[model samples]
Target: MSGSDETSQARALGEALATLRRERGLSQAEAGARIGMTSQGWGLYEAGKRSNLFRPDVQRRLTGALDATPEALVLQMGGEPASPEALPATGLSARGRVFDGAPLQTRRLRLETDELAPWASAGTVLEYVPGRWPRRGQGCVIQIDDGAQRVRLYDRADDAEVVVLGAGGLDRTERIARSRIQSMSAVTARFDDE
Candidate 1:
C-alpha cells in the first residue's frame, strides 16, 4: 500500500482500538498494565505510530488484553460509535453453561504456613473460584505447571506475569511468569480455624 494509505488505515485501526479500550472503562495505563506495557507504548498504538498493530499476533495480544477480539475490533470500526450510557459500568462480561444447574468450579486451599499472615494466616481454609480475575488487594492462589502452588495477595497481572504480595510476610512480593502458571483463582472466602 502507499504511504498515505497505510497511514490512514493505521489511524483507523488506532481509533478502533481506542474505542474498544474506552468501552471497557480502562485508561491507557490500565489497559497497558494488563500486558506489561508502558502507557506510552499503548499510546503509540492508539496514535497510529506503531506499525506492528497490523500483525495478527500483535492484534490478538492487544485485543485479548482488552477482553476483545480482532474481529470485534474490525466490526466496531465499521459500526456506529457506542454511546457512553451504552457502555457497561464494570466492563466485565461473563457467561457460562450450567450442566444440571451445577455451580461453577470452585476449590479450597488450606494454608500451611504463615507466609501470607495478617491476610490469610496459617490454618485458614480459602475457597477460590477458578478462572476468575481477582480485584486488586484480594487473595488468590497461583498454581504452577510443575505442581507448585502459592497463596498470595493479588497485585496486578500482565500478559507475561502475575504479581502477588505477601509470599513470606506482609512486606514480601513476588512476580511469577504467566507461562509457568497452570491456573489462577480468586479467593472468594476464607474460613479461619476456631
Candidate 2:
C-alpha cells in the first residue's frame, strides 16, 4: 500500500461512515451523543480529516457507537479490506457493469417524473448499487410486489415499515409496508445532467 492507497482508504472510510449514519436514520448529533462526542468531532471523522482512522481505539469507538463491527464497516466501505470475507459475494459496478465490486461503480437510471426534481430532474440519470442495501438518506431504486420500480431516498426501514423521502428531497415521502416490497438495492452513484 502506498500513500495514495492510504489516502484513498481514508476517503472511502469517511464516505462509508456518513452513509451508515444516514442509513440508520441517525443525525450526526445523535451518533455523536451515543459516543460522548460533539457533532463537529464526528464530522471530522466523516470528512476524512483524521489520518488515524485505522487506529484500533478509534475504529472500536466509532463502530461501537454505530452498533457495528470494524470488519462490517470495512466491507460496507467497498473495495477489499484486510479481510475479504467482509464483503462476500457482494459487489458494486463502475464501468457500467463489473463483478468485482469496484468502488464508485455507476449504475444509471432515467427518471420520468419531476417528482424528484431540483435534485433529480425528469430524464436525468440515477446511479446506484444493485446488490447493497440503501442507507436512510441515500437514494434507492425499489421493486414493489407489483413489479413496478421507482426511485426514492430511504429515511427509515424496519421489520414492518419502510419510510422513504423523495421528490426534490422529502417534499413527498412514501411509508410502505415492508411486505409490499419484492426487492431493494442501494443507490451508490448518480449522474444528473440537468
Candidate 3:
C-alpha cells in the first residue's frame, strides 16, 4: 500500500481501538499497559500520528490486550477478511485472572446502594460470582460470618485478618478464624457515571 494508505489504515485501527477501550471502561494507561505501551504511546496511536501500523508483533499484542481477534483488528485497520476464531474472547472467564485466577462460577447478581456504604453505591451495578478465598491482600467480594455480611474482602495476612472495604468507605476488619467463608468472587463490574 502507499504511505498515505498505510496512515489511513493506522488511523482507522486506532479509532477502533480507542472505541473498544472506552466501551470496556479501560483507561488509556491500563490499555497501554496491556499492550506493552505507555499511555502516551497509545494516545499517539489513537491520534493516528504513528506511521508504523503493520508491525506484526504490535498487532498481536494489541489483539491480545484488547481481547479482540486478530481478524477483528485487521478489519478495524481496513484490511482483508479474517476468521472469527482469529478474534480473542473478552469474556469474564478470560479476564478473571485479575482476581488471582479465581473461577467466577456463580450467576451474575446486580446490587445498588444509595450511599457508597460497603463498596460502590447507587449509580453502579456489581457482578457477584461465588468462589473460594482469593490470595490474601488481593481484593475480592466475600460472604463473611455465615453469609451475614457480603462486602469487598481484602486480606491482610500480616495481621492475620480479613478487612472489608465497604461502600461509602466503611471498613470492617475481622480475625481470620476458620469460620465458613461461603465463597469469594470479584466485583467485576461497577458504574460510577453518577
Please tell me which predicted candidate would have the highest lDDT against the true structure. 1
Whole-model Cα lDDT of every candidate shown, in order: 0.76, 0.69, 0.52
Ranking, lDDT, top scorer first: 1, 2, 3
Please write out the lDDT profile of model 1 over residues 122-147, one tens digit for every residue.
Answer: 89999998755566688988789999
Candidate 2, residue 155: how far the Cα is off, in Å:
0.7
- Candidate 1 differs from the real structure by a C-alpha RMSD in angstroms, to one decimal, of 10.1
Q: What lDDT does model 2 reach?
A: 0.69
> Which is the winner by lDDT between candidate 1 and candidate 3?
1
User: How big is the positional error of residue 22 in model 1, measured in Å on the Cα after superposition?
Assistant: 14
Decoy 2 TM-score against native: 0.47
TM-scores of the models, in the order given: 0.56, 0.47, 0.46
Error of 1 at 115 (Å): 1.1
Q: Number of the top candidate by TM-score?
A: 1
lDDT of 2 at 70: 66
Give one digit per residue, the lDDT tens place, for model 3 in 1-194.
57786666667777866765664445677667754689998888777676554454565666555555555555444454434444334210011112232344644444445433434555555554454333333345656666554555454322123445443454445554434554445555554545
State which candidate, 1 or 2, has the greater TM-score. Answer: 1
**TM-score attained by model 3:** 0.46
Q: Judging by TM-score, tell me the better candidate of 1 and 3.
A: 1
**Cα error of candidate 2 at position 24, Å:** 8.9
